[model samples]
Target: MNNKRRIDQTEIAEVSKIDTYKSIIESLLFVTGEPLSIREIGTIIRCNERETLEIVKEMEKDYKNRSRGIKLISSNKMLQLVTKPNNSEYVQRLLKTNVRQSLSQAALETLSIIAYKQPITRVAIDEIRGVKSDRAIYTLLEKSIIKECGRLEVPGRPILYSTTEEFIKYFGLDSMESIPSLEDILNNFGEMSKNLKSE
Candidate 1:
């Protein structure tokens, strides 16, 4: 009976540790505002992948069930916290007041291609769009919505472009997977661009 009680106490302690770790991970996600891989999070929390993933899954479930403004989103084994989509209108209003910069049609097209097919080269982007993307790429980089990931191992070692955390935040998406399809983007953003131009 004494041995059984000791085992139960040990289990309780282990559960307590997991709870503490979950809270720490929540704080990290809130502050980072970027996707963090399981490996990265494990290193920071001093836990293994299995443990970290378990905690993250539980946290995700909790956020989903609650009526919270922020939720946890995981993609490609990476995790990030973002405001819920239903709250986008309020956030966009605030952003419009503070941010005067906006993406042009060319810039949006270039960014869409990059967001959908990240780590893509500028040459490939121009080929897909059938036009020069130098100006668009430069604009996106200046806005910090896209960044150079690295050089492709092809001819001339062309630079690869990928969307940044700011892109995810600007779109109010939980993760890259949340990005709309090209058709949806065109249909929806067509209306949006008109509104922006009118304003």
Candidate 2:
């Protein structure tokens, strides 16, 4: 008798119900909302780089055969999920790109600082970077990146600046908790103030 142990149907059913590879791929696909790279997908799913490539190959073929509403798109290192090209126009109308006004780098930076340290004041922001951020703050206020959170207890009762829901949406964050932490910001932010001073 062969000694190979058979994986039970229940186990198979559970795994099938929550297929690690497929689920991870779908999750990554959803996050990207466009073509994603194999490397990026693997990094997001915490999977082996080569294994992620294999998974995407299978996923792409499966979607093609089944004709699902969402399909896998593999372009360069960017693997994103998109509606079939035939249906892109309809989807585009439904989700038109917001072309009202875009923000500049200074505006985005001012917004980020307020976001990470909400209920902060202009003075505090200036202290951090050792420069006046009045223009940047005004720009952010105009863009609704920041709003008056509340009044502080000091003599001047300076208006505290905090990020708005629109700020979260603009930055693709689900909520405040979803925004990266201060430490994460330090790690990821690339010379935010240094560039600001140069400009």
Question: Candidate 2 on 1-199: residue-level lDDT in tens?
Answer: 2333345656777557436778777876686443455776677778778877777777777789655876775644446665666776677677696532467666667776777777899999888767767757765665567788789999999889988887878778788889667887775566786777799
Candidate 2: 10-residue stretch with minimal lDDT: 1-10
The top-ranked prediction according to lDDT is 1
Model 2 per-residue lDDT at 66:
53
Q: How well does candidate 1 match the true structure in TM-score terms?
A: 0.50
lDDT of each residue in 10-110, candidate 1, tens digit only: 99999899889889998888785445678999999998999888988888878987578888877657777777778877888988763425678988999
TM-score of each: 0.50, 0.43
RMSD, candidate 2, Å: 18.0
CA lDDT, every model vs. true structure: 0.84, 0.71
